[model samples]
Target: MTGARITVDYDAKALDAALSQAVAALDNPIDLMDAIGAVIEEAIDRRFDTASDASGSAWAASLRARQGERGGKTLTDTGRLRASISRAVSGSDVAVGTNVEYAAIHHFGGEIERPARTQVLAFNDAGRFQSRKDSRARRDGVQPIAIATIGATTITMPARPFLEIDTVAEADIADVVQDFLRKSLNT
Candidate 1:
């Protein structure tokens, strides 16, 4: 013999058992994905209600609010953006978003540039630029005043991010996943 040879064989039955159970449990994760989606949606809705982001930081006030116009919550004027939010689950994947055209602008914040062909652009002025006298007039139920502006103007919109899951929401998701796994493994 050239040398003493040693041979050893290892059995992976235990590993296979554990893996097979997990694979079978997660074979179809549509329900799990839906549950996760719901958790995320709830967090987003809460953000809208609290006027805060996923990190629990308050969002910047809206232009209207800064202009001394009392109204409903920011980003909920008509509730279109919030109401348009929805979730779609496919297989093991889930997505949440809104189809509103202005959703991105509000979420990301950007500048809107309006160009005027003429030198001066005249339009009706409402609560935006009313003087104290004008305010008195308005308080007396007078009609809105007219105002003029020169050249192109850029309007900057601040970002009010609301499309994310917070730490609490993450904990909720973990609970959901654990519950799913526990139920799956039990069955």
Candidate 2:
């Protein structure tokens, strides 16, 4: 007498369904670089606000004052410089910058010169020197600043940084990412 044995196989449909669900879950990943860029942009805008001194920032007051000064169509004009600022994102990378030429100089203190212009500094009676340029030179025993070459007009700039991330702002980045993920998952 011989005995018969029976074997059973399970279907792979359940496994395939689980894998497909996992793949679907991975389809929409949360991206928060855009939110970071937005926060940075807002900070920059706030730094450039043109409100009054007591009610607003000193930078805002100074910038507003500069609007009426000599530097028209210049990067020092808060409105134009603020407008020139832009943020970029690529995958997980992000960057914030300005198109204005003197933005770097403004953010970081530096000296700029007009090489084509000349200035004269003459010694006064008490061994002191008075510096004047072109038509404004003092006519009393005037002495030239340079003997052979023309002096470049120099202006020393103070640093005024408009883009910065503070502790509060830094801590909010994680919240931003989490919120983004939550909304994305909900959708």
Candidate 3:
């Protein structure tokens, strides 16, 4: 007699019950976002504190200090403390700008063959430079970097791929983005 192939079956009902219980224990999106926001706020506060030489000063104290010493203060260039935190949260090479659009994920044929990655780009506005000593004359200069924006977009992925959820809505993401701006401007 020829050997026959044998297959073993697992109980689907048991697996479903376990998965349901696990999902139930997961945190809601709002709660997760709030937690993230709190952490970000704390980091911003810390950076703001370190950037300023004097404690208890206003948020913009650091910027004012830099301006007083030099012609104009640049948050991106001079605010090392703020930059470090921003980089830590958003990742290195993240920057501020306008009219910038970046892809968070891309899929082929409605499914991802590879892992998803987030990309960020920035565009800055034009500006005119003026020196405190020479007030009347204007010179061409680079524009200040603005906050980068990220919006919601769907990306397809193959079955069993890792799941990524950004529970916060786009509006909320925009709000968090403003935190970086606030820190930069204040300092």
By TM-score, rank the candidates, best first.
1, 2, 3
lDDT of 3 by residue, 1-187 (tens): 5799888999999767656644443322343345455544443444344432122222233244566754244233354323333212242222221121111121012433444443332222434322222212223333323333445556553221111112232345566546644443343
Q: TM-score of predicted model 1? A: 0.72
lDDT of each: 0.80, 0.61, 0.36
- Name the Cα RMSD for model 3: 21.7
lDDT of 2 by residue, 2-93 (tens): 79977888669965665665455445432467678877777666565532122243442244456766444223454677788888887667
Error of 2 at 9 (Å): 32
Cα lDDT of candidate 3 equals: 0.36
Ranking by lDDT: 1, 2, 3
Cα lDDT tens digits, model 1, 1-187, are 5778888776699657767777887889999999999999998899899999988788898876566554647888778888988999999899998889999988999998989633222223453543335455566555445444457889998899988789999999999999998887666
- With a 3 Å backbone cut-off (N, CA, C), the pairs that clash in candidate 2 are none
lDDT of 1: 0.80
The best candidate in terms of TM-score: 1
